[model samples]
Target: MRKSSSLINIKEVLLSTRKVLNENAIIDSDLESDLLVAFALKITRAQLHANINSPISISEQKTIQNLVNRRIGHEPLAYILGVREFFGNLFRVNESVLIPRQETECLVESIINYLRHKSIESPKVLDVGCGSGVIGASILKYFPNIDLISIDISPNAAQIAYENILKITNNNNFHVLVGDLIESIKVQVDLIVANLPYIPTKRIPTLQKEIFLYEPKTALDGGTKGVEIISRLIEQSTKILKPDGAIFLEIDPDQKYILKNKIQHLFPKHKIKVLHDLSGQERVLSITIL
Candidate 1:
């Protein structure tokens, strides 16, 4: 990169980034600007805005240019930062695990409310396919009395999850295992939550560049129908969940019609509800054993 071209000022770089991000992009250009700028300067949002005109240094300029270029190409900001916020806590993220989405927090909130008011003896949680341990850790944050067990098929994912959950919680008596769902798990629990891979294989390539390019395909590619994992999960969940326990799954809305029916058939006596995200698309399915 030429010093002359690279010598473009911070203000100019922000303008260039904004221009490259088309109007139809999911994230607004302004938000992308803030994220890229803050990331490049290694400063907080407030600090970035406060020092926007402070004359970005040589390395800072190079870093800012590259990140902004990537952003303009539709890369996800979380991938660039290598961290994501979930349930009000920061967790390390990469292609190894699914980036925590806001919709999952709704599921977490529901569980927290249940444990907060209801009286139960030693509430236990099983986070099936616990990538990065994000969901389990969030629940652990509030319900310390609860025993938590998280399992993942990938050893790499298990390692990251273990490191993240080791000393972050008080009781810290949780279990992390590397194996397939339920079969590898031994204990019965009050609740089982999963943010399993639900995106249909054919639909993955059409996703935004950030998601398709940066995030791992295994964490997003739901089999041909998108519910292959969920189907297996529901079948095993009945055997693993306590008699009165429940299971929560994050899913794509388009699959609900069939998913709801399958849930009904899989656990005929259970109460099932299909939840919708902010966009009114059904995304979570919760079933409680009767």
Candidate 2:
């Protein structure tokens, strides 16, 4: 067999990949290039660095180029890579489900802290609009004793969530269902946690191309006011939430006051607190039933 002149070493390929990504105005081009190349080679980023001078065959170079082109076209890297890291665990992601965001981790932390403070043994939890099952799966991974039910309107999203929950926690205490918010839930739960659609319809177009063009609109549009679906969930939660149960929701920073008022009108005696993400943005809304 003759070696091809077009063959290149990993260092050369990486430099070229990084240059292409940079030229395309991709954020974190250096990091993305590393990830893309590593993914193409079926190796970890660390491993890629370890074998930096390794030679790349023509086929591997083509694969890397294909992935780079997809990203340059505004396809989300997570979708291209087939997984996303959320709360320290890698969950498979596709256009069917929303990619988990780092800010949403605040919601998860809030729920975990509350559960710890309450010291509830085997708390019954419900995760509404459980896309990719990141929130519910992270919770279950941390607290395996809790019984959780995750619901999504899309069957495909539900399946992805099911797989993630099973893969992440390996616990049978969770159920992933395809249904509207709590509509199919028959029993009351000790807590409800969700990171539902909260971006207003008009604002959808203003989102980054990676989100607006590639991600599912159904998972991004929260109707006109950005609270339509979330409001509905709050309304339905009243019927299935225990008296002392708590609800933790990820919301737009501007939505805190409006959502708080809504919660007040519905559960006047309950406690309402807005939790901030690392950036000091009003992110999570905590509503506790009295």
Candidate 3:
């Protein structure tokens, strides 16, 4: 697309981008426009504003337009930007892994809070289905001394998670392995945390376009009943978790009762607590083996 004027500046480009995004019904068009423009220019949003009046090259404008087109085509903003912030830290992201969501932060918080009170030093943590390594990496950022093992079924996803964990924590206390759940795990751990795929297979198509169309299907589908993978994980936790160990999982609110029952059956002498996100939705499940 050709620019309306020969000397198009950053301000004009941002306005035109926002207008196009708004026309396409994209939410937060203003912020998205700023982010896209800044990303295209390899600059920060603050720098974009400071140089709003500066002229933009034709090549630069074309780059911004390309990104805007991708967004309008239903690609997620995080994928387009190649990064996402979680628990106050930014992690690299791509199509190989699921995009980090704010609600998952609740799981990280609960783990940190539990560890803070527990006397276990250098606790071993097992992160099941570690997409992009956000959960384990976030916890390690706060507790650098802890040993963490992150496992993912997809080799591509595992590689991305490995890179993200190393880049974010810069600590050698974690291992990212490619495996399905905890089947390959032999070492007992003090905690098992997972944000596994929980959306039922039938419900996958009903998700937003950015999710269903672009996000990895393996990262979203949770088998037929939606709790199949989680139930398996809970059952597997029985053999791998150490005594007085705990398990924290991010789950769909609707799956809590079913999962709770499964956990109760498998871990009869356990304490289970459901945590609510800011929106009051039951998001995380904490299971303490007593």
Candidate 4:
């Protein structure tokens, strides 16, 4: 974004942003440019299109320039804008929590489908590492009678999840616990869904800078083999879940066997199934107690 432009309109601002970002090899430069412009105008995407030629005030241009500079420095666009949409709802996000990914939505979908198919009325649900509260919150929004307890080890993540849960639904049946895995809970649940930290410790450095540098390590690192936190969650869930309860987890594509083996070794009677996202990549782990 050139600061020396005399008079700028929304169209010119977006075009300039796209050019600068594309030049720097930024992915999705066009979408990022549109979102930044919409954020600056405080308007919806539809409104942005209707007023594409509207003039941007001098103050607004300067503000957008600052955001552009931040993005140019490899900062996440979600962090720069202060929000990200997940499962069709906007979630407040910062450096404290991982930005909700589209693939994780498969975890939510699998849980919903299981609950409905089994006709599990008043299902007690536990969301482990519930960053932004998107997973559990989406469930509660659809099933108001469902009991949900969402837990995260990070205080900032817990706070953001709490706020998102409240704003997303009026259901008071959900609880946000700030703790590691299921250590903070005593009661058994009908289902458990986790999007835990499963990235290998050594591979964290190999991830995109936006993830390794910007996101919290506690919410990303999975210890030596990338199953430390996930292993703990499965072990604890076996004790706190009903005999016929189920657990769903989001994981890296390569983690399918390692995670399943852990579950089998810990809970030999449990049944496990791997699910793939729309792109046909192995993404979620579904475990049902026998």
Candidate 5:
């Protein structure tokens, strides 16, 4: 015997929602389906499917329609689902920060590999401009002993990062600061990792609406050349990092050559390496203090 439900049909809603999403150019129909249903149920995607046939309550139906309308209007999937996966971990996210991109995971891997080769004493890590704490949290997850400090300029992003921290480790080893990159931290660090905004101000407006309109500009604007934050961080990092410490960052492919030249000019003896991403794009730019 089935219960008579006031709620709309689950399968019907998913079919209609999938069509709506595809119309908006969302190619991953499966992900779109899961996200909408998850939002409607106020449950994890896994849970949503686990009880797929279960009749939805009336209130859930209302919530589903509202969320689907928002998603159809071009809101990001991360913003709709309220989560993002990065570096093999799930982190809370919202419109407050730039969604974690797979490209940045290469930056984290480079640091891990470099540490393995150098056999350095467990290094203390600092992740400046850590939007969702993904970079810092991933580092912590891999090397639990690495002391970490992460910061974001937006308080909302910082709050999201803090929530993520609470979900991960219990040790107070990780510090989440809210402000410009290095201004809030007092302790010296052994490794500096940042994926700061590198999109030039002039180009931001030309980007797709999902980025230009939905995402916060503070996390995207990089001034005239998209090097403003990186340049400042490089100068300040030199003073705080241990002479033997290293720094790694995710950079736009076109900007790598200029950054490499700048590092060579300012610190002639130090060595710099431009790592390439999966697509062979120049991605993680690493600097070793000699």
Candidate 6:
């Protein structure tokens, strides 16, 4: 909170940001400081380093301070930056969609790895609850020839998803639908990927402020049991999925056992594989029709 003259240099601005965020009890203050500084400077992280000693203009310093204020107000860093990196690519994001998380990358990777050896060509892929189109767009980026269809119930989210997909891959092979899960898909796909709302109604209040306060509630609430949307997807997949098609679901670590049981009771013949993320937390459930 010093005069703009004293906070002119990149280092000074970064230090100020860290101080303010730390005072606000923000976790990852260091990384958030760096991101806010780089974003305000309109430079990459490496560029920000290169200009460490360079002077920040009065306007840029004010911009950085404003960004810091937003973070202090519990706004997510991604929303402040207007983009989030997922699967090694940056996708545009806003309050309309749930910010993409690193754990979701596992879902994309699993699908890519599975398809690498399979004979399926132009596999039909559906991304249910495709917020910001990260999952579908990333999949199509890796497998350009596959037919990709992504749907989200939120129109705001659907628009952003469309923009992201078109931004990443200029190809016309992907389709974006703005509707509920299976209702939006008319064709059966070889694979379906979803990162639907899994947070239980009771637990939503306990979520971090960066999430419950800033992110869209529709994208996080999963009704009373938390498995409502996932359960519906399981039932609907039976109608659209090919005989050997698979569904890869990104879920909260604690929901694995109950989800497994739900899937088992619904589809008794399918094989369910629960996959852990890098932290070894149960993250993805790969269900294949046997």
Taken over the whole model, the C-alpha lDDT of each candidate is 0.78, 0.93, 0.93, 0.88, 0.82, 0.89
How many Å off is the CA of 266 in candidate 1? 4.1
Task: Give the per-residue lDDT digits (tens) of candidate 5, residues 91-136.
Answer: 8888888999899889989988887776556677888888888888
Structural similarity to truth (TM-score) of each candidate: 0.87, 0.97, 0.97, 0.94, 0.91, 0.93
- Candidate 1 per-residue C-alpha lDDT over 1-290 given as tens digits, one digit per residue, 9 for 90 to 100: 33364465667667776776654464588877777878887788888777655666688777877886676666677777878888778888777887778888877776676678757867888888888888888888787878889889888888878877774565577888888878866677899988888888899999977788878788888899998988888788767788888888888888777777887887778888877766677777787789
Residue 201 in candidate 6, Cα distance off native in Å: 0.5
Q: Supply candidate 5's per-residue lDDT for 62.
A: 76
Q: Indicate whether candidate 3 or candidate 4 has the larger TM-score.
A: 3
In model 1, pairs of residues that clash are none
User: Which 10 successive residues of model 2 have the least lDDT summed?
Assistant: 1-10
Q: What are the per-residue Cα lDDT tens digits for candidate 6 across 1-290?
A: 34355547888778888899999999899999998999888888899988788888888878887898899999999999999999988999999999999988988888888789779878998999999999988889888999999899998999999999999988789888888888757787899899999989999999999998999999999989798998898888888999888999999888888888877887778998888888888899999888
Backbone collision tally, model 3: 0
| Runs off by more than 4 Å, candidate 6 | 1-7
Query: After aligning candidate 6 to the native by TM-score, how far in Å is the CA of 235 from where it should be?
Result: 1.0
How far out, in Å, is residue 151 in model 3?
A: 0.6
Instruction: Write down the worst ten-residue block by lDDT for model 6.
Output: 1-10
Model 4 lDDT tens row, 1-290: 44345767888889999999998789899899989888888998789889887788899999889888888888999999899998999889999889999998898899888888877768889998998999988989988889899999888899999999999986778889899788979998999899988888998999998887798988888999888889888888868899889989998889888888888888778888889997889999999989
CA lDDT, candidate 6, residue 283: 91
Candidate 4 residues lying further than 4 Å off, grouped into runs, are 1-5
RMSD (Cα, Å) of model 1? 3.4
Which scores better on TM-score, 1 or 5?
Answer: 5
Q: Count of backbone clashes for each model?
A: 0, 0, 0, 0, 0, 0
Model 4 scores worst on lDDT over the 10 consecutive residues at 1-10
